[model samples]
Every structure is written in structure tokens, then in C-alpha cells.
Target: MADVARLAGVSAQTVSRVSNGYAGVNEETRRAVLDAMKELDYRPNSAARALKRGEFRTIGVITFTLATTGNVRTLEAIATAAAREGYAVTLLPVALPTQDEVRGAFSRLEELAVDAVIVIMEVHLLDAVTLTLPPHVQVVVVDSDAGNHYTVVDTDQAGGTRAAVRHLLDLGHETVWHLGGPEDSFAAQRRADAWRAALAEAGRTAPPLVRGDWSAESGYRAGLQLAEAPGCGAVFVANDQMALGLLRALHERGLRVPEDVSVIGFDDIPEASSFLPPLTTVHQDFAEVGRLCVAAVLRKVRQEEPERGTTLVPTRLVLRASTAGPGRRDAE
Candidate 1:
């Protein structure tokens, strides 16, 4: 600390501000402090500082898994937003979110004495674990309602699915087939519900629901079956990765996209556009979701009154070449 302060020609308090991400330091001083720290190879002892301050100036995030593109994007956005607020983020990934695993992660965070916790476990099992957190710890849930009391931030999965199905219906398609995500996921259930409701509202026979584990391979398997089925003109996939797989499967089966099938997917990932035919999908603003979650949880931690309920982030459809008119060659 002394060496960095001497080299940067700033007080110890200024060095502390630079390390803790406390605002109010001028740009020149902040740059000089960073340069000095880099030259001296001085690493701030986060643990020691956290112990002394009773506040880590850091938050812990728990996610069910990082296997899917949506999960990964949400976590990245949360980290980026937290850093901008001068808080560090620590991610805790749970491969299989058993009761013990969730409990254990919270216990560990309790020991670290972090300011708050954000759990991204989007399954039903997480609710059991969240009920037992120590009262002092403020918790915010992502994509799942932990309970009515704690803060919850969720994407408008149902609304997005409704939009996609309605779009297909307006395009003169009689009915839309659904390629759903894992049964355990809250998002998949919401999407499936909305898809069914839209069909029911129009007095149409709801097509058989195809299930996937949010993987491209599973979507490809479902696609193979749907491609062979009669009157399967339009499909709404749960996520883009599976949509990519379905597109490939249709191509290999000598079926033409938009000509033989029109598909819509969720999560407008960057790769969606670069596909052989650009993908038509829904966009979830994960960065906004992250920012909302952080601000929500921190408000509770700071003893400020924030809206005490769930927040739904809006989604939009990005139409692309993957969807088009049903051709005259439909199997009768």
C-alpha cells in the first residue's frame, strides 16, 4: 500500500478508493494508481479487506449450470454490470442443483460475508434451498420466483413465445408446432403454456409438443420426426442452438427452409445471423436483466425499500431468412 501510494503520489485513502472501486477519484489519479499497481505487482487482499469492512463490495451469483448459451450470456452480463458498479462478482456453478448443493453454496457465501446473492438456478428445486437463507443476506433470483417476498427477475418467455406463434398464424399458417426446452426449466414451461394457449384461443388442434434438453442434437432428433409428419409447415423452437440443429437436419433430409418449413427460435445470439440462412428468433436483453437484478438486490442490502416482487424483462422477435411462406408442396 505504501509503495503504491508513494509511486502514484496519492494518499492511502486514494489507493483504497482505486482498489475498492469507490467513485469520486479523478481520471488522472485513477490511471496513475492503476499504473503504479501494475508496476509494483500489488494485488489487493480481497479477503482481508472484506473481513475488515464487513462488506466484501462483492456479490455471489449461483447458476444451475453454464451449459446453455442463454445461461452463459446472462452470467456474463451480470458480471459486466457488477464490475461497472465497482463490485466484483464471484460465480458459483452447480452441475446438479440438489438441495445439499444449493444449501452448501449459500453457506459458503455466508462465510465470505458478501453483500448480496443472486441465484440463476432456473429450475423448481431451487425454491426449497432459497427458503433457508439467513435473514441478513439479501437474495435476488433470476428467471425463477424464489418466493413472493424476495426479489425475482425473469425474462418474458411466455410473451415471446406468444409473439412467435401469433406471427406464424398471421402469415396464414393454420397451426404452429413447438420445439420445447427441458421440462424442468421454468422458461420451457412458460413457452409451452403460451404456445398451447394461443392455439386453443383459435379453436385449432395443438400440434404434438416436441421436447428437447435445450441442445442442438435433441432438436435435430425432434426435427427428423416433425419433417416426416404431415402438415408440419411452421415450427417454433425453444432456443437458437436447437434451432440451428433443426435447420441442419431439415437440410440433410432434402427439405428446404421457408420453402418446406418456417422456423422461429429464441435468444438472438450472434451466431444466429451467420447461419447459412439467418435465424429468426427472440432477443432477451440479458445485460438489462443483470443490471436489474444487481440493483434490486443491492437496494435491499443497503436497507433501501425497493419494489418487493418479480420483474419481467421484455423480449423481441428478430425476423430473418429462417422463416418464410409455406410452399405449395406441402404433403396432403
Candidate 2:
């Protein structure tokens, strides 16, 4: 520390301020300190600093998987938000959704050098035993029904599903068929329940649900079944990737989108607008969800009482060419 300070002609405190990214260091002096450190190949001792401060300025993220678009997007947002807040994120990936795997991840929390944790996993996987974490480690959860026990941040999945279903119904479709995601996913379950509720509210019975594994392939399979079924005019797919597969299956079955079977999907991913006919879908604010997760965890870290109950980032319906009135069949 003194060698770089001597080289830069700055005090040890000035070097510390520059290294820690603290304000009040002039640009020229900061640049000189950085140049000296680079020349000397000096690295700040993060562990020593953390020990002195009593906080690591690091966050641990535990998740079962990042296979889905929602998970990947949410994680990306979390990382970005953490970086803006000057905190590092350490991901602890669980091999499975089992309670044992989650427990194993939690057990190693102290060793991970994180002051707080944000868990992004299905709520059901967090049993009573697995929910327990090491003492003094604050937590915030995403996409789980852990609001009653932990600070929760998530998209308004049910509200998004309702908007999609209602949009289809308002287009004169008698009943909207559903292509749901996996049975175990809390987000998927919420969407499915909302779809049903929206249908019942309109005094219409929902068609049998066709479940998918949140994959384009699973959606293709489910699409094949829907294509073969009679009275399958409007469909509400759980996600955009699945909707991509469903669109393919319908096209192959001599069915034209909107003209034959109007479709609406969730998660207005970037590619949604580039689909064959473009996708009219639900847009979730994943970045907001991530920002809230970091904010909530930092609140706990600061000994502040985070607001209990779920913080739902609202979603909106995006209109595109994929959906239309049933009477538009001959227009295609």
C-alpha cells in the first residue's frame, strides 16, 4: 500500500479511496494512483477490507436452474443491478430442485463470502427444512411463494396471464385454449390459475390444459395435439419459446396464424417481434424484478425492515400480427 502511495505521491488514504471507488478523490490524483497500482501490479485485499468493514459487499444467488428464458433474464438483470450498486454477485447453482440440494447450497453460504442471498427457485422446492439459512445472513427470494417468510420479488405472472386470456376473449374467441409450462414451476402454476380464473370470470369454461416443459420442443408436441383437436381457434401459450414451436406446428398442419388459430404468448422476449407473423405477447419487467431483489436484500443487509409480502412487477400485453379476430381467416 505504501509503495504505490510513494510512487503516486499520494497518501495511503487517497489510495484507499481510489481503490474502494469512494468519492472525493480528484480525477488526476485518482488516475495517478491507478497508474502506480497498475505499474506495481498491486491488488487490493478484498478479504481484509471486508473483514475491517464487517460486510463483504457481495451477494449470493442460489438457483436450481437457468434453463428458462425468465430465469436467465432475471439473473442477468440481478447481476447488472448489483454491479450498479457496487456489489458483486456469486451464483450458487443447485444441481437439482430437491430439498437436499438447496440445503447443501445454504450450508455453504458462510464460505461464499456473501453478506446476503437472493434465492431464485420454485417455492415448493423450499421445504421447511431447506428454508433455514445460517444465522445473520439476510435473504430475498424471487419467483416463489416465500413472501410470508421472506422478502419476495417477482413478476405479476397471474396478471399477465389474465391480460393475455382476456385479450383473446375480447377478440371474439369463444374460449381460449392454454399451453402451460411445467407443473412444478410456481410462475407456470400462477399463469395457469389466472388463465382459468379469467375464463370463469367471462362465464366460459377453459379447455383442457396442454402442459409443456417450457421448451420449444415440448410446445411443438403440445401444438401438434392442439392442431388436431377441433374448435382450437385461440391459444394462450405460457412463454415465447413455446409459442415459437406452437407456431411451427400450426403452420405445418396447414393452419395459418390469426387466420386459423390466433395465439398469444407470455414473456415478450426480443425475438418475439421477429417470429413468422410476429407474436402478440405479455411483456414482463424482468429488469425491475431484479432491481427490486437487490434493493430488498441490501435493505436486510443494512438492518432495515424490508416490506413483507410479494413485490409484483406488473406486465403488459404487446400487440402484434400473431393474434386477430376469428373472422379474419379469409383475409390471410
**Top TM-score model:** 2
* lDDT for each candidate structure: 0.85, 0.89
Query: Candidate 2 — what's its lDDT?
Result: 0.89
- In model 2, the clashing pairs are none
Best lDDT goes to which candidate? 2
Candidate 1: residue 199 Cα off by (Å): 1.6
Off by over 4 Å in 2: 2-42, 125-135, 327-332
Candidate 1 accuracy as TM-score: 0.85
